[model samples]
Target: MKSNLFISALFALTISLASCNSSNAKPQKKVETEKPDSAATTKIQVALLLDTSNSMDGLIDQAKSRLWNIVNTLTTLKYDGKTPDIEISLYEYGNDGLSEKSNYIRQVTALSQDLDLISEKLFALRTNGGSEYCGAVIQDATKELKWSSENNSMKLIYIAENEGFNQGKINYKEAISDALKNDIYVNTIFCGNKTEGINIFWKDGADRGKGKYFNIDSDRAVQYIATPYDDEIAKCDEKINKTYINYGSKGLEKKRNQAVQDQNAKRVSASNYTDRAVSKSKAVYKNESWDLVDKVKNDANAIAKIQKEELPAELKDKSTAEIQAIVTEKKKERETIQKEISVLAKKRQQYIDTEAKKTKTQDDLGNTINSSIMAFAKVKGYTVEK
Candidate 1:
């Protein structure tokens, strides 16, 4: 009886211990659920390296009028109406060699927050010649703008010049390679009218640059990049966070960007003009000068008629006599007003070149930095995309 009683007590105590152990055991962890963050997904930077040259007037107009569309597209990206962070830049080509101020360049930089300055520069652009596409691309993708490796920002470039883009000193392949090294993507926007070979070359550039290549034959790139009609009021105007519309004219200050080095930016020769006088000065071309040339011809003819006529030798050509008489009168005038005018013309050209240098360089830098800012704004939580 005592043994049976002791066994019963032992069994009860063992069962109680097992029950306590089971109750005290910790439960398994449940898998954590998380909300999808667009910002966390991927950061993006897009540079619109457009051709702001002679044949791109229509293209320029489109970009100017519809910048908002691209902005609107970017606005659509948001977790709860808060946009993603983005950076957008703009560039132009086909204005080099002929004039210092007029050259290919990346105007806007890697940001999109300021649509106003982008609009101003886009509108300010006019057509010229010389397409240095590769040079500008390399400058923007690697040199000037601040790109972060930590954010995984998608650096993209769009080349939109009508001409074949081999003019810039850098090779197309090398430009794309530089871009790729920085993890930036470059997309080529070519018109359908471009040569097959040229188009193929761009395709190669874009592929190597690790970006999409688009061929739009029409002058509708701006419209194509637009958002639907319903989404107009997008980015907020926060000073700390940066919003569109207020990006104001900040893009005008990026003159020293590396991509700008290859551009024929106009420079003011600080040298003072020659205070000394001379009998003969070089003739420069101008519209008013052309008018002067015409007027001078008339004055010369009047002077010839007023002068005593000398009989020409029978063997001498009649045309020769007329030319000689004209030359003599021009020589006489060279010592007076004409000489002074010539000097003034040189001075005028010097001043003009200086201003041109400032304007063109400012314009180029303006476009590059502004475009870069826009690209940045798009990537940095704005729901806008272009």
Candidate 2:
């Protein structure tokens, strides 16, 4: 009886131990993920070096007409919820009108945020039959331009030419090497067939700079599909222009140039005008260097530094409070116009998308640029909204 009683107690203790062990077991844990550092993001800098020999007239025309579309496409991109500041520099090479001693290369515009000034410089470009110095221009641009030292900034040099890439005194290989040393990717766009461009060493030029090469039909005219919203956007842009109160020495001249560019866009096509209007509506369209309204908004002490005589005729006699009130009124008006353009731009884009699907054509310089830029941007972890 004692042995049987001891066996029963042993069995009870074994069951209790098993229950305690089961209850003491730990639960499985979930894997934790780390967030990305947003500070790693940077801005984009683009230099367009175009061969402006007499044969490149069509190429120049396409560039002028499509500038707005390119600007608009860039505005769609964001890095870590912050929009990247864009600066574009323009260069014209192989134009006899330019000095041969300088390899027939002219820096039309320095890297600038002033989109209107860029447009003006582009429109002013006139082609002449000149020696196409591919190597020399690339070298000069690489060495002359102030490229960003930031590792994250996208510094690109797009050289568009129809001639062989090995032209001029400077060696193409060495020039491209210099570009690489500066972290500037030199992209080559040949105005011919892919095989032809490859045979001319255009592809090799791009490869040396660690960039892509493309061959495009430079003579192809840009086709525009007019949208119903184009008229309204153009009208809204005029209203938006009215809100800008010109101040400072350059303010009046730059403001006048704005209207001149509007006309130039219209000369190209209605679609171009509409696209320019859309670009103007974006935050990238800034005139802070000269415009009082833009300057004052960004700098609190701007008004105090400005000479009273530099103020616009309407604001010259006004008190600081009165000037501020005028600026406030203009800002409100500008915002309303921008919002309207934004809405219309969306509808215009949707219409464009549906129409683009039906066509079998390559885009002009604008879309070509947008394609290359977005591709490079993706590699840098940028988020393109469009």
Candidate 3:
């Protein structure tokens, strides 16, 4: 009888141990299941590396004129029916004003969502006499930028130069290979004849990096198509600017910069200015860091948490509820303005598209980048809304 009892006890002990192990494993499994998928929040990162040598002045001008158009194109993309975050980095190489130790390369902006800052830097670029080191600049961009690691994210590097691709100490082959390993495609844009570009290894760089190559007449000016709806869109832009409630330390400065960027776009051309206004109407033109309406949209309780001192002078004396009410009113006004602008923009685009079919215009910096982005985005399972 005692032997039987001892066997039963051993069986009971085994059951207890197994039960403990199962309970211990439950939490770990739960944790793993709850973990977020990094790929679900995909981003589109673009690096613009422009050769700012003396001969490439026209390239810079083209870039300045097309910044808003490129941005408007990017905002149309959706990943899995959701808009992905967009970031752009700028680099100026082959400028004598830049340090030789850095291979005449200056990172104008790190991969960022601040479109105004990108515009500011692009306009500030000035060409100077310097060696064009394509390989070194490519290597720098590949190594230095905080490129997205998600497999679904689109990472692109567009290097525009008129010089030989193999003009630096760093081999273009190795640099492009490293970029590919990081899932970054390096597109080469030669500002000259196609055959000469191919002979100078520009085509080879694109092929090896799994990107497109094109030769553009850099001296040619960007052409614009004016629409009847552009004047209404400009008026909407003015109204939308008034709806932004700037708060925080840099709020006023950023607000001023917004107007400055508007002026910059207008300085480019009436069509370019309309593009910027249309872009501001989209969801991607967020100014959450400074605009109270945007901040409150992301966080319902943000107004309550913000210190009075951080708020604009007009709102400093108001209570949290008052501030919230003001923000809500401004938000509604902005949305109305945005909707009006959106309608006008659609009409404007239709006009441009119809006009475009009538002329076979040569591709410029904006057209090349925009077309390539759509192609790359489709390959990565992103959809474009026409």
Candidate 4:
């Protein structure tokens, strides 16, 4: 009875141990969002805000021609195992700056890759009157434009108002509050004035919005491309070049691994089946271990009757060598693509430079006409912080 009790206790202990092991073996959370092909990772949206105040025609020209350069720069950029989500929205605020027009807060275009449309809109715009900067920020821009704060997405508002904020019924303070609420980055590019008060108001708006601020000197600015088309093409090439090198290489590596897996699986299966057949044969006849001899004989016979040639088919896997070759081949392909990207990028930059010259020509013309206006600004002692 004591022996029987010991066996019972041992069996219960064995069951308990098995249950504990099973529970411990379970994984916590299953991982979702498996890594996809290289192309699947890049996505970022950008908004370009233009200052259409009477003084920034040349600046606008630079922006139109250089649209691609900025995006191309981004292609070389890397994030935490992800690509940027790139989109562009064009908005010009000075349309209302120059006028009491209700539609002055203009959305030239929504988030898009069609940069040409933005360039065209920028080219078509004329600098005019009123700038209710705070209202544009607090009301139209922050509250109205399509953006998601929850996605932790890259949201930006590039504001280039030449003058200060004067429009919004809501005060500058309120605009800051709203910008913080939206988690928006408002990069301010001030062209004419570098002094405080006017430009500083825009600067503070940018600061509150958690964005960078830059003051571009008209004379110092260089147009990096000859045309908007060239800019777009170069920018695109830069992206393809950068990503194809990294992502394309990665894709090829995966294929190589797949090939190896295929090769390995075949060999493993071939060995496993061969061993199983041998073991069964020994057990049935050589050892006479099977109590059901006839049944064991039949099973062994059935196993032997199975086609051995089919074992190779079951075991056939794509070899690692084959996969490695594919990787090399893809790397070569990407190198070729990268060279093309470089050429195209160079051509686009040339266009940007050419466009700069043309825009400068326009700037010269405006400078001639706005001489009195320029003199008035100088005379007013109205200087913003440089």
Candidate 5:
């Protein structure tokens, strides 16, 4: 009987040990990680606030003609093996056409990737006599636009005006303070002589914001040294237009606007058209919402979401397989054209640089903005390929 009791106690101790070991063991868990957005990793937000009073017609013209130059400069920037999305917002201040109650300022466009629409607005700007309100416009732009919060994003405001920086009810100091609070670098381009600009407090405005100050000859005409590659680049741009399969209600209209912008750029000069084409070939010229090829490439389920009736007239009755085939073909063609354009643009730029060395060209708004962009871009870990 004592031996039987000893065996029973030993059995109880073994069971307790086993139970404690089991309780201490951890259960297997399912770990999950979030996927990165393949589209864009970084962004460059630029706000171009221009004075458009009657005396500043030259400034307006420079803004309109040299927009593509500014865009092309941004196109060369890259960080972490991905090109940044470029969002540009335009503001025209001191135009009498604008309401006095609104301080003669208008937010022409929000920060967006719609390059064509931006070109359209720039072309449409008309000068009028009005009071120049530097503070009001900057404050409005700072408060209104949806600026990126990413520390990597290069956020900047280039306010070009030829008037006293302190010529408004809203103090320039307060505007600069607000801009700095939002992590926006406010660069001032005084559209006159350097001494005159400093006397008018333009340099002070830039100093307060810790941004660059330029006294540019805004009235100077943009010089384009036409290269042998310009014609080929222009042809490639036209070929790209054919690849766009317009879808949705806005597709046709948007596609038409693209053509219109091309024409407008051409009207400026052949080199201007080439610049626009080069910009279009880059990743920043996205029209996914309207272009069927871009839409399908980005989202596999995009076609499934779209109603049959919403498709372009040419693609309305096509079967799903047939539609996919069409998109694939267009995508291939566009890629080829873009590659050709890229090659030609490099050659064109080389030619332009060689000529710039031989000429005594006055500094216009384009080169001025390009200088600032390149300087800032380097600081933000962006490398310009050319």
Candidate 6:
């Protein structure tokens, strides 16, 4: 009976050991699988908070004109020799059209990769008479948006306003401090005189946030320098547009909106239009939500997964293999067009740069934001490609 008891106890201990090993093994496997691939996971998040009160129409116009220019500038930055995904969020504060209960602020768009949607929202924004609340908007953006927690990711918030920095119930200092905790730097752009901006605590806000402070002439119009390559780039833009195959429920609508945005950019200036075209040639201007070519590029099985009803009329009757063939062809066509545009774009930029040397650099929304982006990116170990 003692020998029987000893064998039973030994069996129980063996089972316990097996159970513990099984449990430990799972967690170890989970950790291995869950480890993030930091090399491919870097991102750049930028939030633009613009005061859209009655006096800030020029600021709005500047934003509209320079949106593509800013995007093109951002495309030049790379982290660890790889280009990071760019996500932009927009906010409009001090607009009386917005709810006063929400401190006259509206989160226009959450941090998103949809460049077209951002352009559409920006174009829709209109100024109205309202009280400006810098601190409230900053605090709201910090808490509400889904900021990346990665230490290597570059996150920035640029708030442009002519009003006093210390406004509304929320304290700017505390708001900026909270932002800093999330690794977000809050830059301030004062749309008036430099001394006036400093006197009104704009500089202090930048200091507290550890970001750059700039005073821009928001009322001044953005000057465009036309180049000989603009016409060729425009032609390439038209050719690239043809390569997009619309799919999904919103595909057709989004395609129409893309054309509308093109018109909007053209209305700004020939140079602005060219800037938008150049941006479209870059990898950052992906429209996977609506474009089948882009969708298939991102997901190898996307063509097989797509429903026949969701495809465009021309593609709806095609078999899966046929559709795939078409997407492949379009992809190849797009790449070729994009390459042509890129070549022309280099020449266009060179001409513009040469012309720009004749004049003093204007401290406008685009220049200030672009310069600050370079400065901040360098500090974060990002390299700029020429």
Q: Write the per-residue lDDT of candidate 1 for residues 1-386, one digit (tens) a residue.
A: 99999999999999999999999989779888875564554445556776756666666655553343344333334523444455567666666533444344645545553333454455556767665556555655567766657443456666665556566566777767777778776666565554563555766666676654545443543212111211211111011011101101222132122112112111111111111011012221111111222234446443233223322232134464564454455445543544444445344435544665554332122233335445444554444321
lDDT minimum window of 10 residues, candidate 4: 283-292
Tens digits of per-residue lDDT, candidate 5, 1-386, equal: 99999999999999999999999889668786865553264789999998989888888878877899899999888877678899999999999999999999999999999998899999999999888989899899999999987778889999997889999899999999999999898999999899999999999999998898999887777777888888888888888999998888898999999999999998988888888999999888999989989998889878778889889878889888888888899999999999888888888899989998998865788888888888998888888775
Residue 346: error of model 6 in Å? 1.8
TM-score winner, 2 or 4:
2
State the lDDT at 142 in candidate 3. Answer: 98
Task: Tell me how candidate 5 scores on lDDT.
Answer: 0.89
Ranking by lDDT: 6, 3, 5, 2, 4, 1
RMSD of each: 29.1, 11.4, 3.2, 22.7, 3.6, 3.3
State how far residue 312 of model 2 sits from its true place (Å).
1.3
The CA lDDT of each predicted structure is 0.45, 0.87, 0.92, 0.47, 0.89, 0.93
Q: Any runs in candidate 5 off by more than 4 Å, and if so which? A: 1-39
TM-score of predicted structure 6: 0.93
Q: Which stretches of candidate 3 lie over 4 Å from their true place?
A: 1-29, 33-40
RMSD of 4: 22.7
The digit string of per-residue lDDT tens for model 4 on 153-197 reads 555566665566544566766765676577665556666555753
Clashes (N, CA, C under 3 Å) per candidate: 57, 0, 0, 41, 0, 0
- Residue-by-residue lDDT tens digits, candidate 6, 283-344: 99999999999998889999999988999999888999998898999999999999998889
| Candidate 5: pairs in clash | none
lDDT of 4: 0.47
Candidate 3 local lDDT, 244-285, one digit each (tens): 998889999999999999999999898898999998998878
Worst 10 residues of 2 by lDDT: 34-43
* Model 2, TM vs. native: 0.88
> What overall lDDT, based on C-alpha atoms, would model 6 receive against the true structure?
0.93
